[model samples]
Structures are given as C-alpha cells and as structure tokens.
Target: MKVTNVHTRRIHQPKEKVSKLFKTLATTNDLIWPYENWPAIKFLEGLNVGSKGGHGSIRYTIIEFNEDDYIKFQFSRPEGFMGTHEFKIEALNENQTEIRHEINIQTTFETSLLWIFVIRWLHDALIEDAFNKVENYFTEAKKKATYNFWVKLLREIYKRKPLQTKIA
Candidate 1:
C-alpha cells in the first residue's frame, strides 16, 4: 500500500524566526515536537545529514539537512515501512511561514494493517500536537490538539507496554 500523509501549520512569524526552530529539533531545547507528551525524537549524532534517530517505533536516518529550510529522513525500521518523511519551511510572506511535515511510503500488507488500525491515528495526533506546540511558541494564545477516542485509547495502551522508542 502506498501512503502519503502531510500536515502543515502556518505561523504568523517571520520566516527566519520560524526557520530557526529547525535547529533545535531533537535537542534539549526542542520547541516543535510535542516531546513533553509523546516520545521524544533523538539522534545518535544529533541533527545533521547521516544522523540516525526516530520517535517511538519509527526509526530513520537523516538523508538530507538544510539548517533553516528543510530536513528529510528515510525510514529503516518498523519492518515494512519503506520510504521517507520530511519537514519543510516555506515563506508565505515577510511575516508568515508554513511548516509542513510530509510522509511518503509503501507499506507491506501487514504494515498496512498496522498503519490503518493503529499508527495512522497516533501519527495524526502526534503531528497535530507538534504543530500546536510550534504555533503556541510564537503567539501569546496557546494552541492545543485534541486526540480522538482511538488515539487516546492507543496512547493508554502504549504507556502500559511502551514500544522500543530508542533505535538500536
């Protein structure tokens, strides 16, 4: 099965400021990834081309990196995931920028089932929460992403028997 997923958020901030957030990714000062509530993204050699890391059961290597513009990661774990995911920053205007997270991959039959029943719900919620975190950082008003019933339930289950969030 071919899966293509994209999530984006527009922030009312300068492109430079928005772009700076990319540098903090997977770091102690990360302000984008909703790591406080979910699994934190970590890399063995930090954020750079060839650095390997991922959150939860997902593992990937940084295939490309551009400090203030883009980052792409190619998946290597979770069995049947085959392809890449990337984050892009686009300037819409002098003071507005968009952050986009895109995933493109082909999945095996078994992984398709996992994606349809479990990972899809969790992944969507996770991205939304991450976007909310990014948006909240620049605005006085906070943004929050709510989870659907399935995501809430699945998160509870995982908390009991946590997946291998660390890459080997």
Candidate 2:
C-alpha cells in the first residue's frame, strides 16, 4: 500500500524571516514539534544530508537538504515503513510564506493495517499541533491545539505506556 500525506501552514511572516528558520529547521525547530509537553523531534547530528535523528520511537536520516528551502528524510521505522518525508518552504508574497510537510510511503499489508488503525490517527493530531505552533509564533495571543476526543484519549493512553514501547 502506498500512503502519501501533505499538510501545510501559511504564515504571515515573510519568506526571509521564514528562510532564517531553515538553518535550524532540523535541529531546534521547537516551533513545529510541540516540544513543551509533547515528544520533541531532534537530530543527533547536523541538520544536513546524512544526519541521523528521530522523535519518540521514530527513526530517520536526512537524505536531502536544500538550505532555506527544503529538507527530506528517509524513514527507517514502524517495522515496515519505507519512504521519505519532507518539509518545504514557499514564499507566497512579500509578507507571507507557507510551510509544507509531506510523507510518501510504501507499506506492507501489516503496516497498512497499522496505518489505518493507529499511525494515521496520531499523525493527524501531530501535524495539526505543528500547524498551530507555527501560527502561535507570530501572534501575540497564544494559540493552543485542540485535539478531538479520540486524539485526547489516545494521547493520554500513550503517555501511560513505557517510553520504549510506544511510537508516540
């Protein structure tokens, strides 16, 4: 099975301001990873091609890096996940920019089942929080992520599990 998802966020900030973020995009991008109370994404090495990193139970290696524009990571986890995911920045106008995060993967039957029943649910919530974080970056009033009932319940459940056992 092939699974592809693209999630985006448009910021009021200009591309130049957003581009400045690319340099630290893979390393300390706390703006997108829900670092305060959630699992934070981190690269074990430089945020460039060949760097290794992961968050929670996920593992990936940077495969492509285009400074100020794009970065791609090859996933190597979830038992049968095979593919790449990327983050891209596009200038929409003189004072606006957009952030796009996409995942493209080929999965085995078992993995497809996991995606349908488990991963998909968490992935959506994760991305939504990421979008909200970006919005909060520019606004004076803080923005909070609102998860659905299931998302809330599942996250609580995940929090109770052993750190080494869950992909959350």
Candidate 3:
C-alpha cells in the first residue's frame, strides 16, 4: 500500500522564532519532541543530511535537512516503509506559521497491516502531544489532548520499551 499522511498545527509566533526548531531537531535539547515522556528521537551523528534516527521502535535516516523550513526522514525499520516522513514550516504571516508533519510510504503486505492496526494509532497520539507542546510554547495556553482508548493503550505498551533519553 502507498500512503500519505499529514498533521499540521497553527502557531501564533513569528516564523523566524518557529524556524529555530529545525536546528535542534532530534537532538537532546529539542523543544518540539516531548522526549521527557516519550522515547527520544536522535540522529546518531547529529541532525544533518544522511544522519540516522529513531523514536520508540521505528528507525529512519535523514535524507534532507533544509534549515528553518523542512526536514525529511526515510524509514529504515519495521520493514516496508519505503519513503520519507517530513516536517515542514510555512509562514502564514509575520506573527503566525503553519507546521506540517507528513509521511509518504509504500508498504509491504505485513507492514501495511502494522500501519493499519498499530503504528497509525501511536503515531497520531505522539504527534498530537508534540503539537500541544509547540502550542504551549507560543501561546502560553494550556492545551489538552484526549486520546482514543486505543492510543492510550498503545502509549502504555510503548512506554515499557526504553530508548535513550537524548531529545528534549
């Protein structure tokens, strides 16, 4: 199966300020990834083109890293995820920006089932949490994320597996 998935958030901050996120992505001090509660997203040799990284049980390689604008990671694990997932920033105005997280993948039969039944649920929840953090940073507003029962359940499962605590 070939799939394209995207998640986006509107941030009420200057695009210049928002763009700083790209500089520390997948690093120990990242502001976007909620690594304190979830698995770290780390680039084994720093975040640059051709670097490698992962979160939880998924692994990927950085194929593109365009400063302040976009980054793309091609999946390398949980087999059959052939394609890249990327984060893109689009300036909406002087005081607002749009952040889009997207993934395009062609999967094998077994991996398709994994995506349909498992990975999608976890992925959505994780990104929701990520966006909430970003919103908090710019708006100083408290955002609440309500997960479906399955996402909540999957979180418990994923939390059991320990990965490095590199990204914040």
Measured by TM-score, the strongest candidate is 1
lDDT of 2 by residue, 102-121 (tens): 99999999999978877787
Which is the winner by lDDT between candidate 1 and candidate 2? 1
Whole-model Cα lDDT of every candidate shown, in order = 0.91, 0.79, 0.83
Off by over 4 Å in 2: 26-29, 165-168
How displaced is residue 167 in candidate 2, in Å? 12
Q: Identify the superior model by TM-score, candidate 1 or candidate 2.
A: 1
What lDDT would candidate 3 get against the real structure?
0.83
TM-score of 2: 0.89
Give lDDT: candidate 2, residue 14: 95
Residue 145 of model 1: what lDDT?
A: 77
Residue pairs with backbone overlap in model 1: none
* Candidate 3 lDDT, 1-168, residue by residue in tens: 998889999998988888886577666679899776667687778878888778876888889888889988888887788988999998999989999999899999999999998889888878888888778877656887888989877777766765444422
- Where is model 2 poorest over a 10-residue stretch in terms of lDDT? 159-168
Candidate 2 overall lDDT versus native: 0.79
Give the TM-score of each candidate. 0.98, 0.89, 0.91
What's the residue-level lDDT of 139 in candidate 2? 86
lDDT of 1 at 125: 93
